[model samples]
Target: MQGWRSSMEDVHCTLLKLDDKAWSQWSYFSIFDGHNGLDTARKCAEDFHRYLLKSFNEMLKHGEPIDGPLKSSQLDLILFRKTIKQTYFFMDEQLRKSKTQHDESGAVVITCLIGPEVIYFMNVGDARAILVSKTGQVLLSTHDHKTSDPDEQHRIAEKGGSIWDNRVEGQLAMTRVLGDFSMDKDLVPPDADIKEYTIHDTNNPLGFIVLACDGIWDVMSNKECAKFIVERMSRTQDLCKICDEVLEECLKRGSADNMTIYIIKFL
Candidate 1:
């Protein structure tokens, strides 16, 4: 639950909490990276949470008649991705008309749901999600979204945008995201792009999640952060304290963009 910004731009928003509702038992955590302005970032963060809840409710409505054949994993990913895409489209269209964001406007979103024995993750863009295990192992991490990937580069080129030095010139750092209406319209007939990821239990490991913006990740490696967290947890095992240390470490390492982290420990 810490946020550090570099210079004046690069906005980030985060939320961490334990949930005990009638629908499920889990802890929810999320990070939002707003590119154009903090106004959109703040609103995106608030709206995403609501969108998730609505998605779950919709699943319940559609799943009630399934009897014992209901599969949470299959349903969750499908519903979550659908909900996120719909939500992003709604906001992108509204922001284009409501705000002064003449430039492309959007945000990268990463989320984690820690359930009793598994973790569900979804991400769009470079913002990351990391998991640490009790045995001091780095279990799960997401790849960044950028032009380096051939698929990403192709998408950018198709949209009449160029990727330089791993950035979307004046738009973003990745090929996919939640908004960026101006850029979307220029590149396509309707000018919109939305993406999502669904990580099943097959590849997950036994570590806490290290969710942060590129500011921190840009300067560090997946293995390096994994070792750092493992070493810290071996001593204190207090997640909040570990978060503080990770933030400072990133600053000391000279991260120039905004640095924000959402650490989720499965206890």
Candidate 2:
């Protein structure tokens, strides 16, 4: 939802199946929260997945199973993580080389690659994601990359950057993001924070996962949003309506920015 924003700068991507062949069984979803303008986010929504698919397929050709917790040495797992990080950088580099001036703006991203037995989350800036258990317990949550984070502060400082008023150079709130070519590259990097979570549907079962922009996080705590959805799901099973209501709840609670949420259920 656009909420109170004068212009809607947010965009999203969802693919039930990433592609054919080995990728046919995988899924993808992501939120790109744009700042300054929508071009960066829109471009990411259209092209980011392609880079990911190409990278993953190349890894697959080498017999590195897409479904991992690879029993054969940990090289495969290490390579898997490396590939994810490289893809983010590659996307960023592509943007840096774009002929258009869209890179002047920026977009924070939270991307998920949902495989048969595991989920991979790659994020930058404040767009976040979380995976919940069957009983509504949050199994994992992404840490936002903002000025308030000491590590992020150090990262910027190491690059000769300064923070003023809790923003990078007092202009941007996030320490990392895609695009923003006008800023110091080391200060506002496009490096992604990647994570992995193994899915267990039998011994522990599964509940749902939530992915949203900082617009929602600005007013709602992780548990608050998760609890609201868990309780609401008991009363209704319509996921699409639930997503809309989640955005509405954020608006009513004083979120003034564009809001986007994705609720993926396993139970």
RMSD of each: 4.5, 2.7
Candidate 1 per-residue C-alpha lDDT over 112-200 given as tens digits, one digit per residue, 9 for 90 to 100: 66544446666767788766665656666776676677877776687677777766665456666666655554432211233322334
* Clash list (residue pairs), candidate 1: 105-180, 130-209, 130-210, 132-206, 132-207, 132-208, 133-206, 133-207, 184-191, 185-191
Backbone clashes, each candidate: 10, 0
Cα lDDT for residue 167, candidate 1:
66
What lDDT does the true structure give each of the candidates?
Answer: 0.62, 0.86
Lowest summed lDDT window (length 10), candidate 1: 188-197
Q: Could you tell me which residue pairs clash in candidate 2?
A: none
lDDT of 2 by residue, 111-168 (tens): 8888877788889999999888777788789999999999999888889999999899
Error of 1 at 76 (Å): 6.7
State the lDDT at 154 in candidate 2: 87
